[model samples]
Target: MNTPSNRPAKGKNRAKLDPVYDLETRERALALVSHGRSLNSVSKQTGISRAAIRQWQVRIEPISRTSKCSRPDDLATYSYLLGLYLGDGCLSRHPRGGYVLRIACADAWPGLITACRDAILRVRPANSVYLVPKQGCVMVTGHSRHWPCLFPQHGPGKKHERHIALEPWQQQIVDAHPWELIRGLIHSDGCRITNWTTRMVNGERKRYEYPRYFFTNASDDIVRLYTDTLDSLGVEWRTARQSRRAQNVSVARRASVALMDAHVGPKY
Candidate 1:
């Protein structure tokens, strides 16, 4: 019987081998590349071969091109995302490259979390979306280089501390899909609640229930934008003070609440 030895095979008998990398490793490498780092630099930092990185780039280029070739066709989805962003969304610079957009959704509303994730995908399908759990809320986050381009309202300070205004194109989208925007805003920071009081009716004390919608925000500019849109839709609203610093845009009129019910309703 012939015995095997620790000798290298020659010619056709030699086996070909290639290193395998995990998806997370590949993503990290690509993220560095996306940040405009040189291939040599990334290769040295990531311990990945330049040739392999090049192959990855070529393989993914077509997909990126197809996904980001034009603006999203779903303008309504974009409008809704805009409302969510203005309400509870924030943009932070990514350590690798580009920016990350995060929208806080209450854990109680799983449907809203799903909706927020779906909306982010619709807007930036090429980017990756993540759900991060917090003390009482879930953060819906996505990574993209085009976030600033899409959300021009991003600035140096808090949204309420600075001016918040929409671009003309954004206004056009909001105009076309005003209900979707309102629904998003309501989902983020507004709520529909029932108030009750006892009154004498037919010589008997009866409790009457009143359903109203309240949109509370610290930003005067955001409040103005919301009320302006409501006005355009003929939805009556008034500014009421809930506290010394808290102002709520209240919609208590039967007709207005009916309109809100027909469109926004209550958050899930």
Candidate 2:
């Protein structure tokens, strides 16, 4: 019975396979490292090698929200941020070299304003995020060098006039978190509300109410994307009449509203 067991010799070298991680998991681990977690500690907790952790942290070092190289990890959060940017986000460059990012959310929906602020804080923690009230909307503004990295759609002209298209990575992120993207779009340039009207029933005037979601954007492509997203979610939508310069799309119907409510509710 002293015959060799099915095992390698004590001092023999064995091949090691590198770990494969999905984008979300990789982002989470890198985020932990950015938040001042020691590489060894993160490696121990995440079961990832310290060397790999170090490399991940280093890869996003320049575009990190924190000086320590921590970037936002949640896919939904980034997708929401992108939606806010595409809807009413703006970027301004500083004379010193960095950039300022601002997204306008209606003050009526304070929750959305808070959400925007939180999103910026999660990505660019160092920058002071604040609200600037303009007309009926509140602008969530912050400064960061890597904002363009997140919203590559930044350009000189308005979104509608420009050729706004999502990149492969961004498309992947949106595909993974379509609801969040929809939430951002609605929060920025859309609304979910109950419309009411009066009708004659049995020779008597009666009032009826229905819930509908309206998304108004000047960009046809953006509207197409919005409708496409609704189709993917199996929600019904149709084009609504709006100004000649703007395109309006509406999602109305009991079942469709119910489905949308599951993923996106009115911004409080």
Candidate 3:
């Protein structure tokens, strides 16, 4: 039998190119190509690819250029390690290669954390690129840069979020991982945080600050932190709309309460 090699193979373009792009750029490139920009024009202008530009505009969806990583014999570790490291920043501390996962769609639906977990199971990481769940998406990015500079950059002509966000859950994750999302989205919800409280401090409106943290389906910490922090600051906030599902049944009781006796009001 021929001897097997133990070394990891190199990428197609093995040089350490900057790994700072997010899904928004890809969508912007797609839109540009769809609007009649040529691949060469896109390349000269955006620095991605003639091929990628072509793929975006093609009538048939073309193949993805990003490489996927897998272990021939060690399939378990990277996959097993991804979740643990995601929480503790184990992989982010590496000397090289990490990635950001930014998910986008044309539909009017909000993504569930289950969708994120599913995507992670499907995509493979590249040489230096690895997949870790970034709140609602799995990040496949390089580790050299902190997350703040990684994905979902804010700027004019960038890909925009078409759907209303998932609320304080997304806010918490963005706080912890600024690179995971554009700061614009974080600030969008800033209004809610402040609006929930009218409690003035020193004659000025008190501001609610979001603590930095990552969001995950596996944990409630993000939600807990958000609600707790807001409550501690005396901000009058409620859980997300989805969270309101449980409260819906009792919501009708507001009218019913008026029909009950005050001394023996229906117990909550």
Every candidate's lDDT: 0.86, 0.80, 0.34
The numbered model that scores best in TM-score is 1
Worst 10 residues of 1 by lDDT: 62-71
Error of 1 at 108 (Å): 1.3
User: Candidate 1 regions off by >4 Å?
Assistant: 1-43, 46-70, 242-244
Colliding pairs, model 1: none
Model 3 agreement with the true structure over 94-194: per-residue lDDT tens digits: 21123333332112212322333343343333224444444443443343222322222211232222211233433444344332221121111111111
TM-score winner between 2 and 3, please give it.
Answer: 2
Model 1 vs. true fold: TM: 0.77
Q: List the residue pairs that clash in candidate 2.
A: none
Model 2, CA-based lDDT: 0.80
Q: Put down candidate 1 lDDT per residue, 135-206, tens digits, no spaces.
A: 999999998867888998999889988999988988999999999888888888888999999999889999
Where does candidate 3 have its weakest 10-residue lDDT segment?
A: 185-194
lDDT of 2 at 142: 88
In candidate 3, stretches whose alpha carbon ends up further than 4 angstroms from where it belongs are: 1-41, 46-56, 64-73, 89-126, 129-218, 221-268
